[model samples]
Target: MTIYVNGRFLTQPTSGVQRFAREILTALDRELCQSPALRDRLGPIEVLVPQKVEAPGWRRFGLRHVPGGRGHLWEQGALWRASRDGVLVSLGNSGPLLHRAHVLCLHDANLWEIPQAYSARYRLWHRALRPRLARRAAALLTVSRHSATALAAQLHLAEDRFRIVANSAGHMLRLPSAPGVPARYGLTPGGYFLSVGNRSPNKNLRALIAAHAACGSKVPPLVLVGGEVPGIATQATAGGGRIKMLGRVPDGDLRGLYEGASAFVFAALHEGFGIPPLEAMQLGVPVICACSGAMPEVLGDAPLWFDPNDKGDIARAMRAFAHLESGKRSAMVHSGQKQAQRYCWRESARVLAQAVAGVPYQLPAGKQAARGVFGSESRPVENLF
Candidate 1:
């Protein structure tokens, strides 16, 4: 039987979910070439993609273009029909519901956990399609245990139904940090606090800004690199440009910014497996994220945790990092890299390969762990991955 990778992620703007799909394919391709056992067990593997996508260039997974529409229409109609003979692996949340021999990696229960983040259509589609997809898939995979439990409760499935195939920060390590980024942004090395995420409701942007405002200009400036939220300009005005919103940076520049930061901050109310913190840790930057969601679980003791709901608490964490003792700050960098090292795309691919091949694989220890991570060369990535 063939194993078909769902390639719709190639078309969409990247979030953490799209990053998961891309890296899993890259690592799984590596596994097929290096591991004879896995290669033999897995017969022919192909990426069943639409005709329109600029698919990743992979040696092992052959690309088969199926003609049809785009988005969910394409995945459900064309891609589904093309891969019916084989097991379809959909790494992002959406997939063909009619296909029973499927493997899906649902990133979070965001629609249910934070309903304000999505439009009603997106929520309705996810609510309708995801549970059916999960119920029918050959394997249901998620990023972390917190996500697994949330998804199980939301989708009305058993906790045991989901498997963990984690995330990592090797992609950030892959990029040669671009030196021009700091000069272009007029940022001093180690004199800015970096927070990367979109202006979605779950990002807790309002409170994050409020905290930064409370911290005042005595601390490092707050640098936000993603889309803008409403009233952010007004908030920034209060701080006198102390909060800089440089929307959506490229991977190379992002790596540079991460390397030059005094600290990395994340204020998400919910996350399945937070990728930005992991990315920061990989670049040897200390992280301070909300104590909520998967932060405590994914980051372990590496970060100085704060409650996302409390702006005062966030202010304290921000100030704490700014005024951190040199010795303690170095300790944070030390533990953070150690924690980040625990997650590998190869190991994740091993688990995914096993699920695809009907074999059980053991997971190495650690919390879950992507890029400074990019592959497609023609177009630039604008989403917060």
Candidate 2:
């Protein structure tokens, strides 16, 4: 079977959805290398990209341009015309509505679950379109079991209809550390708490700020990686010089930030399946995560959980993590790395390939499970000696 991928995500900014699409596609191409026989299952695959934009090159997958404009119009018209003949795999949670043989990957039902986090237009679009697309697609995929349940209920579809293709942290290991990132951010290795970045109100940034304030100067200084800066800017210095927000950063700088942090703090609410904490885990960082949404389910006992809804609770977790002994911290890193190993982009892409090929899912030989070797070289910054 010939698989045509919706490469539109390459043009979008790197959000969770875009990140998932890119990683899965990248892994799928690599999967072709691991199992040459699998190429016969899915061959002559073309990533359909928009015109005038440079498409990502893959060893196995070919890139084809769909001419016209960008965004919804281009997807509905040019993209549909290009892939209506084959099994179109839309990784960015959407595809041509009329295309019958299609695969749609939705990360969550956040718009339905946390309606307040989205705008009227954004909510309305998904509310109206996703259900229809879910029913029309040949296969449906989600990031986690919690998300599958939430989406099934939200879309009025069967829970068994969705396949789980989880996100992983392996991608982080590929980027080399940016040497001057710590100095540029006025940071020192093992001397700062790193918070995962997102601008959404549902991310619970206000509570994070309040909690970091409560930690005071006793804990290491708190640094946020990427998030909205407008409203939070006024309160950025509210921690009495303990809080620092770096806004959005390049991937290399992010890798450096994750490597140097004493502990990784995450307080986002209603995630489909949080990826940032896993990224930290891959780098051997201890994690303090919010216990809401799919995080507890996805992270297992890898992280110290805190109530994102309560600023005091968040502060308590931070304090507890800060006071942990070196031995305890080592245990946390080991547990985190082990937990993060369960999800692999390559494995997820294999699942996707079988679905796209219209074949009954087969566990490829030697691919029974992901050993998750990406972070095998990792150790906490303090233990680097």
**What TM-score would each prediction reach against the true structure?**
0.89, 0.88
Candidate 2, pairs of clashing residues:
none
> TM-score for model 2?
0.88
Q: List per-prediction Cα lDDT, in the order shown.
A: 0.80, 0.79
Runs of candidate 2 exceeding 4 Å displacement: 178-180, 227-240, 359-385
For model 1, residues 1-385, the per-residue Cα lDDT tens digits are: 6778898777766667778888888877876677654554666788877766675777798887788987789999998899877677899888888876778889888878888777667777778888888877778899999999999999989999888989888878878977668768889888899989877878887898889988887578888887643211212222346888787788899999998899999999999999999999988999998998877888999999899998999999988888889999999999999999999987888778667654112111331111111123312211111
Candidate 1: the clashing residue pairs are: 167-369, 168-370, 171-372, 172-372
- Note each model's CA RMSD in angstroms: 9.0, 8.8
RMSD in Å for candidate 2, one decimal?
8.8
Winning model by TM-score: 1
lDDT of 2 by residue, 1-385 (tens): 4568888887776777878888888887776766655665455788888865565667888888788688767888898889876668898877788776778898898877777677666677777878988987878999999999999998889999899989999999889977567878788887999987666777777788888888887688888866542211122223337887787888999999898899999998789999999899988999999998899888899899999988999999999988889999999999999998988887887777656654212223432212321123333211211
